[model samples]
Target chain A: MRWKCTVAYDGTQFEGWQSQPGGNTIQDFIEARLAVMFERRVVIHGSGRTDSGVHAREQVFHFDADWSHGPDKLIRALRTGYPDSIQVYKAEEVDEDFHARFSVVKKRYTYQFFEGFADPFETRYFWSTGNRRMDVERMNTAGKLLSGKNDFSAFTANPGEERDDDPVKDLSLLRAERIGPRVILAAEADGFLYRMVRSLAGCLFDVGIGKLEPEDVLRIRDSRERKNLVLTAPAEGLFLDRVWY
Target chain B: MRWKCTVAYDGTQFEGWQSQPGGNTIQDFIEARLAVMFERRVVIHGSGRTDSGVHAREQVFHFDADWSHGPDKLIRALRTGYPDSIQVYKAEEVDEDFHARFSVVKKRYTYQFFEGFADPFETRYFWSTGNRRMDVERMNTAGKLLSGKNDFSAFTANPGEERDDDPVKDLSLLRAERIGPRVILAAEADGFLYRMVRSLAGCLFDVGIGKLEPEDVLRIRDSRERKNLVLTAPAEGLFLDRVWY
Candidate 1:
């Protein structure tokens, strides 16, 4: 039977959330850890794949295992053996047909930064902006344009994916707010188009820095051309906050 | 002529903040970057040395360079040249006798934790706590005891260079507050004995988890015995927040 579990991981040491050739992948590592205890090869499926150096607050995954252990014991074992960068925040038993990715309903994300000189101690976890004051209002206005259902082809990175052919996506929410020198981008969506968050952040950053107008979001959205988008926000600023099915 | 610059770095890739013989260190990397620009070797003196996986908000450093560039231009160039992880937040020309460590009056530190369900995104940057809800209020009450001058030998890790007889430290601030599921520890002291913040965090974490009583701080403080301390808080949570000279 399949069991879905909510997990969290540090993405700095990973290539991305998905399996990759040679590079460390969060899924591969988790599967390895589970394999040791369950004595079987388990294919771990995640709600969504994140990029290198990205983080997730709560990620959903599922795997099939036959064991006498209860959910709590499984969680405890995973917690004890999982790499420091990866953790099983919670564990639950699901019906055999439950799928972590296809069943997910919404996802949330947060991006952070440090103003002035970041405490060197916290720099790894946050983007650093020495002293460039930003216009949060403009970024927020532009962010509002990204809300609702729309084609997000302009914001995706890998345009070759067939997702562009059916680019329309339901963006339930997107907001860029400022905290000190840091910016908090809280976004919620039924599901994200590839690189959509990064693309939106890049545009909002442009607006925040006075490089783009809030109205520019409409034009960018209408164009639906990935090449027409601004820069892709650095992977460091993006995070996967949570997933709900 | 000499200049004092406050620096910030992401220590994930380095051995630590201090210069060492073989591994890459923040100090060595900064010196290398400076050498490439000035065509000569330059040594930087930092206010503190943090360990691997540690971060700093504003780390003060001083260097002697017979260069003609202004602090502003030097700052810009240095920032542009350094890796994204290393940033020169601000640069100032200092009096010849200014010392980053000796002249410092107080230093503040913070420890961050993304408690519960290890978030993949915050994994490297925040410590994770699974299966246990954090008792922030208890941690806060215990933290208050550290606000004034006290014998802190029990709260420091390594405690290198400082003799055991020198256990007294004047602390100006200590706090543990909650922001979301995370805790922010704000600590300031005239000067910290080695590993003091991390050591305190370990004990406080135990207190938050109900293992240590809030009043137990007095026992730990009075014991001046390192053997009684719990595990050192993971390096990832520690941040050099600020300095007041």
Candidate 2:
């Protein structure tokens, strides 16, 4: 049977979800525990691979095992076995064919920025911008230009990525809003190109800083060029908000 | 010249505030950075000495110096030099006789609890009680017994403490408030004996779990003996909130 687990993590402590060259990864750590829990070999598939220092709000993952344990018991086993930095929020059996990576309709991501030195309470969860003032209106307008299906080759770090062969993606929503000095730019799309969210965030940051106009985003979206459109924001500021099945 | 530096730390990674025979200590790490900044030997005296795996909020520390540099520059230097797990929020000059430990007038502490299981967001900052239901009102009523000057030998845990002769303290306030599923106990006092906060928190936990009545707190407080006290609460839930001069 295959099970779907909604997960959240403080990604700072791990070397990212994917197995690293020679370092510990989130998957490696969780698999170690799953291997013990199931008493057999197990492979877990996540919604997508998040980079190191990247956070997730409701990441989905699926794992298969022959054991007949209920969701609650399996969740308890997973919870007790893994380190505190990784948590399984919810667990449930899914259709055998349900794939966390491929079955997702869209993925929503939000980038967070808080003004002032981060609160001792929030340092791990937010990007502390120190004293950089951002123009929310400008950033939002630029975000509005990105709310449709388009070839987002310009808004990706490496346009030559294997997934970039099909750069046309349906961007369902792109909203940049301000809750005081904190700016949360959230975007959801049927699929994302490699580093698409960070690259788009960098463009919005340029707009917020008056370095680029809102219309420039439209030009970049239409051009489909891989020229001066490759600024990837820091991974710490990005969050995998949720994934729609 | 005198100085005070507000500190934040991940206590899980340190052997408390004092240097001891251990892998790492908060003071040792801090003093190493201070030595680098001053270009000589430098030591910091903390307002409160915490046990292993305990954290702080506005932890006051003072160091005498003869440098021409202002306090702002020193703050920047410390912030730049320290690791991400630790942070210096403020630095400033004070009177020559103003000592960090001896001259501190009051200190605030907070203990955090999470329901069911630990949230990854608060892995370092909160204590999880698994499935145990905690009664906030009972904890609050028990907390009231902690006010005023009293012998808190029962609430401490340092059998090899050097400050064994100084066991009495004046507690200004003790409060238990529920924020969401978390019941936070915030207490303030003129001074705390070693493990005092942890012991008091343990008693509150006992009250929360119905093992003891709220009235039992006064009995324990007036006992002036550590024999009947509850077990020491985990260090992760405890924090040195502030130190007032």
Candidate 3:
């Protein structure tokens, strides 16, 4: 039997979602607890990877196992065993063929930042940009050009990432908005490359600070060169918001 | 010259608000920075004290100093030198007779807790009370009995605090409300005894859980003894919300 689970976590304490030898990652913790509950080595898979210090509102995962208990008991046991920073919100049975990562049709990510001064209580969740003023309207104008299927080679870390990896992805939405002194940038797509969202956010920040013109976004996308853009934003401000299947 | 400053802090990292021999308090950090800026020893007087792990939204402090720079420059310098968890929001010159603690007319405090499941991001600021259902309406009805001038000996730690310490205080407000899964308890008073708010919150929590009747609160107050109430809520969920002069 396969099970689908919805998870939310504050990623500050974890190395990321993927399991590593250090045993400090979210996957490592979840798998360890599942192994304890099932009385055997149990592996749990995640929908996608998030960088260290990045947060999640609704992340999906799935696992295949046979158990004597129901979903409610499993969720209760998981919540009790896991750390406070990790929350397993929902769990239910799924088809055996279902997969957490491959079955996803769309995913959305949001980045948050603030200007002027950072609030003491909010610094953990937002990127504090010091005293610089940003032109959010210009950033939003540039974001419209990011929509559509395109080879985002310029926005990815390296075009030479594995010979079979695809640089072309279907981007459905890319927009920016200002909520008081806080600025939010959201992007949705069928798939993203290595650090693609952070790379694009860095370019948008340049547009906001008048370092690059709005039309420069279009030119960079057409360039198809990784050197066309620089400055990958920090991971602390990013959040994996949602996934659709 | 005496300068009054409005301060806010996430007290998770500090020993408390007052300076101690260990020099780990909030006042120690502020005074250390002020000493560097003024090129002399400096001391700060706070409106009141908070326990370790307690937060503040608008704490007040006063300091006497003389320097070549103006208030704006001083504020900017202090902000740059202070840690991200501490914020000096407002600073201005005040009359010599004005003192942070003595000139205060009122102070307000708020305690926050959440029922059901806890949000991952809010774990630091709110108390997670798992599976317990609190009657917010009953808690509010019991809260009304806390107002007016009364010897809050039943709600405080003990009457042996000082030679002339007064247990009688004028409380203007004590209210409770529910915002979704979160429950907020706010209290306003001309003064507070040591751990008075936490003790009151504990009794209210008893009433909320049907462990005690609302009339039992009046009985406790009339007893005028610390032995009547003994539970003191944790410091992490307490916040010094505002100070009115």
Best by DockQ: 3
Cα lDDT tens digits, model 2, A1-245, are 88999888888778888876754788887788888876776889998888888888788889888658688887777876667888887899888989999898999999887766666557766777776777888888888778888888887665344652478999988888888878899999998887889888888887887788888888888888766754677888888989999
Worst 10 residues of 1 chain A by lDDT: A157-166
Q: Score the docking of each candidate (DockQ).
A: 0.42, 0.56, 0.69
Give the winner by DockQ: 1 or 2. 2
Model 2 has how many clashing residue pairs? 0
Candidate 3 local lDDT, B13-40, one digit each (tens): 8998988799888899999999888899
lDDT, residue B212, model 1: 88
Clash totals for all candidate models: 16, 0, 0
Candidate models: Cα lDDT each = 0.78, 0.82, 0.86
Off by over 4 Å in 3: A158-164, B20-23, B158-164, B228-230
- Comparing candidate 2 with candidate 3, which one achieves the higher DockQ? 3
RMSD of 1: 4.6
Model 1 regions lying over 4 Å from their true place: A109-148, A159-165, A186-188, A207-220, B10-13, B51-54, B105-237, B240-244
Q: Per-residue lDDT for B133-237 in model 2, tens only?
A: 889988877777668888887787655846744778888888888888888988898888888888888888889989999998888878778865577889999
True contacts kept of 1: 0.63
Instruction: Using TM-score, give the best candidate's number.
Output: 2
lDDT of 3 by residue, A1-245 (tens): 88898889999878888898999888888889888887898888788888778888888999888866888887888887777888888898999888998898999999887887667778777887877778988988888877899999889875344635578989998888899999999999998887889888888988999998989998998888887455788887888999998
